[model samples]
Target chain A: MMLRQGALALAALALTAPGMAQDAVRSPDQIVAAAPARDWVTIAPQDLLVMTLAPDAEGNPRKVVIQLIGAPFSQGWVDNIRTLARDHYWDGMAILRVQDNYVAQWGQPDPGMGIAEKPVPEGLKRMSDADYTAGSPNWLTSSTLRATKEPQVIGDWPAPMLTDPYGDYATFREGWPIAGIQQMHIARQWPVHCYGMVGVGRGNPPDTGDGSQLYAVIGHAPRHLDRNLAVVGRVVEGIEHLSSLPRGKGPASYYADPAKRVPILSVRIAADLPESERPHLQYLSTESESFARYADARANRRDPFFVASAGGADICNIPVPIRAVAAE
Target chain B: MMLRQGALALAALALTAPGMAQDAVRSPDQIVAAAPARDWVTIAPQDLLVMTLAPDAEGNPRKVVIQLIGAPFSQGWVDNIRTLARDHYWDGMAILRVQDNYVAQWGQPDPGMGIAEKPVPEGLKRMSDADYTAGSPNWLTSSTLRATKEPQVIGDWPAPMLTDPYGDYATFREGWPIAGIQQMHIARQWPVHCYGMVGVGRGNPPDTGDGSQLYAVIGHAPRHLDRNLAVVGRVVEGIEHLSSLPRGKGPASYYADPAKRVPILSVRIAADLPESERPHLQYLSTESESFARYADARANRRDPFFVASAGGADICNIPVPIRAVAAE
Candidate 1:
């Protein structure tokens, strides 16, 4: 069994070897050798939601993805709410509920006003008993879980896309894990909750109103949310800010006193900004050498103090580190 | 059967009437009535630790609790962590780790240098993993599990403390609908993973390290932590903050880059401060009238909107609201 596990692990890693070899360090060309520019498409400004709140931890707005209303969205009518986020669209809203553990929502608290918050007025009103609604109409690709796969998926993340046995236990991709459980069929995809992933907040009334208020997944990754909630986007950076706010003193996190509500100064889509004004950025290539190295550093974590190498890692624990892309 | 459920619920409510009347509303005795004066105790400054980070959502230096070596401490840690807080120290620190349907943790990520950035070297360590390490050398609480429980631990929070109505269903805590085989004689008391609960985080060694990185029961409230970890506090106030942090990137949340780590400014015990420096905090005594209303609000949740209230509130979902004390 051990040998088989090992061999299977190695077999899975072979897929990413070519990609890792050419570019492994943290540089502008990190994944340039491995991916075509087509892989770097920018998200549409309307499709992206930039949620801003008074500075808490990272000193930036709490951002999320706002996929368009589509077929996947179970609450049928909501699709008509043509969203245009940048111009103070979802600010100064009321929190519908703060479902402890699952989400802390804020937006149009009342159903009457909730529907009004959407651009297309009478979208959809979910039943009180509905489970979850989908976000976008994008069809998932066959190999979205991993540009490649690995031996086993301890959890949802690919184990090690690229590996250097003597060095790191990973098979490189665009700096993301690509190993494990490829056969299990991860192609069935949706936005799985992780810290900072955003979802439209709803209640017993799943479609009573297409979500106008939103909540960020701030705790453990709520995998069950996959194919369920309309997950718009994730916080590429500055999650610490949102995850440390003072909780609501009222029902469903609608602070008993409005004074407790955090304020929003502004929210903007990164892509909407002028080319010279966007924040410096670069996401680690899921398939890269620096990524593998970083993973190794984390897997073993021998920072002059940690005595043992846990040799294991949770997928949610492995966030694809984003950085300020260097100036040419 | 329905009638019985209503009766039991009413009886449970009748049990908490006296405590609410004690709050004068006007004078409130300043400190005593703010929170249960008897329950209000000091935390040792030696045990205090603070964490400072701008989480994923906002860009602000967020502060949190982190304990050092000497703090699995029973009491007397700081002069007053939140001096203006009512309920005395009851509102000091709050819970942070509510994983969606999992364990909720509470502790400061950083308190002080030694306390903040640790696995502390100074505090007491459980001598061994033996089940008998008692809080006091008195009667040791033996931790065990029920042989058959189902859905069992809906993601880790303890099985709700429930009772059967009409003996048809095996109602349990966590406000879940359950059907199970009973073994009354085998009932054991373990610290349940209810929402807003506080727990300690240990290294793989289990007992090594100080309480620097604190978390809360933001998710489903993992019941497994009960009896396994030391639960020190709860989210008497804000919880949305911790649950909102973007998931950490890397192994078990040890950021791949040390710079990604949130810093700890300081942590002081609530008791260390002078009496005059305490916060005027108030809590709807879990055993009070407001509590009964709060509990009912959760149990039935007949909000004008809830088409269905699930009719059950999990132990953790029942928000234990906290507030600032109104001085006379």
Candidate 2:
């Protein structure tokens, strides 16, 4: 049993092999592959965090790349994360918890484990719960915010807005998935919790996390966490390293045995790495024509394997495609 | 870093431990634990599929339990699955593909593997593509189907309907999450592809799978497959065994090295096992008041950890609670 990618395009093109379809009506992967280099947006090195974990059981190196969210959303926590990375604060930390169908969190081990808590670096921002969401930036014009129906035209591009149950509307902005609502002639938007989205883990009321502790969504998108926690960024690559980790047996999936923790070797900002060691990556611009077609194709599958197309897709279903920059 | 379940109720009750909340405004987990025995419905052994995989590298037993969908949805494929299980057709099969953020499929190995395909047992039903969906059952009344807004009342009970992007409406019916639409005064509905939901896998068009091949959703809800493939059941337990398996490197995440495939020891219907070996499981009835409150709590988290509650939840986010029946 197989759900081969680009099956529809292959059949339509009468090709025996996968990924050979070149026509206009192509698979999502094909569309992304055919996207012009001009449509790719290179992520800034300062915005990238390279986390190196201890070798797996087979002694294979494991690295997870996280792209920090830019301005207009959770910048306070994002900045704190950068500070922590720069300070090497998480160097000796370990993955402490992995909840099934939930999250895999890493930070200081629980005090119950008899481990001393490491002090966080100075110069971290103190963010309030209100910082969880932001006033819709200028890019989200008033007209777009006021549109009552979906497929609203945002800026110069006609974004394929989704009908969401979590918010008034769900759409993409600045290469990120966001949900928003119009309130008193103002728009309030927040980065959503899609699979692989990174978030700050905090204690109870009045304590928005300081970013010393972080977690990645490893299962279904836990939308309930949106607006409840500060979404800092998303894992751009190597999520399998965390998602496949053995789940903790303790409450909330915390590792009950201190010895079982997977050690974090180091966390470094891409800019801090040597010039020759930096990893170059780019994402399909959300505003590009290729992305529009890709989003539409995700919602409506014209591939041969599909007997019926889902007329629409949820925000998390249309993940932005990211890839390593090809060597020039 | 933690998302402690029932945090709100614990704080409200001034309890220092989890699961101590007795009040109505408790967490979703608390609500399920407090549900009365009558609100829990036992799943018949005949409908349970016990799949035993080879011991893990650590020699740990790995068993996955699946609950088959009952009447009014994919019953033809469901029956075929039962026949295969009774005939031990998949005893020696191996898990073939595990695509990240997609599915884990197992069936006959690729012809390129040089392994002979086992002929399917006789008397297996040949289902058509039309069986991918079914006419709304008698239980789904016309009034419920025609509701134009959220939280429609079905029968005497009010089901918390969700605003869905893929269908006209999404809600729970007979303890299963479903999406449906009303057309020409007739209702058509099908099971959804939520994480852990199992489905029959087929090749290209007109060859609707005969249940010889099967796959399980291991990531986010791949709703695009809804009405395109046949959803037969869900993994009620031990999904981590599959979700944590090493992802394949071959195209479509098929294991390129045939030696890497995890062997399936056996598949058996719980009813076919010895009486003492049968698993006793129960699920919170979707029609019960406890479920109504749980669903509401899921959509709106009054939990102390949450600063802003999501006003609503998608169908997949509100998974039906299933647990083993304690020995009396």
Every model: Cα RMSD to truth:
13.7, 7.7
Q: Cα deviation in Å at residue A319, candidate 2?
A: 0.3
lDDT of 1 at A317: 40
Position B204, candidate 2: lDDT: 84
Instruction: Give per-residue lDDT, candidate 1, residue A176.
Output: 26
Model 2: CA > 4 A from native: A1-24, A137-158, B1-24, B137-158
Best by lDDT: 2
Residues A236-284 of candidate 2 have per-residue lDDT tens digits of 9899888888888888989887777899999999999986767788998
Best by TM-score: 2
TM-score of chain B of 1: 0.53
Q: What is the lDDT of residue A191 in candidate 2?
A: 95
For candidate 1, give the lDDT of residue A271: 60
* Candidate 2 residue-wise lDDT at A84: 91
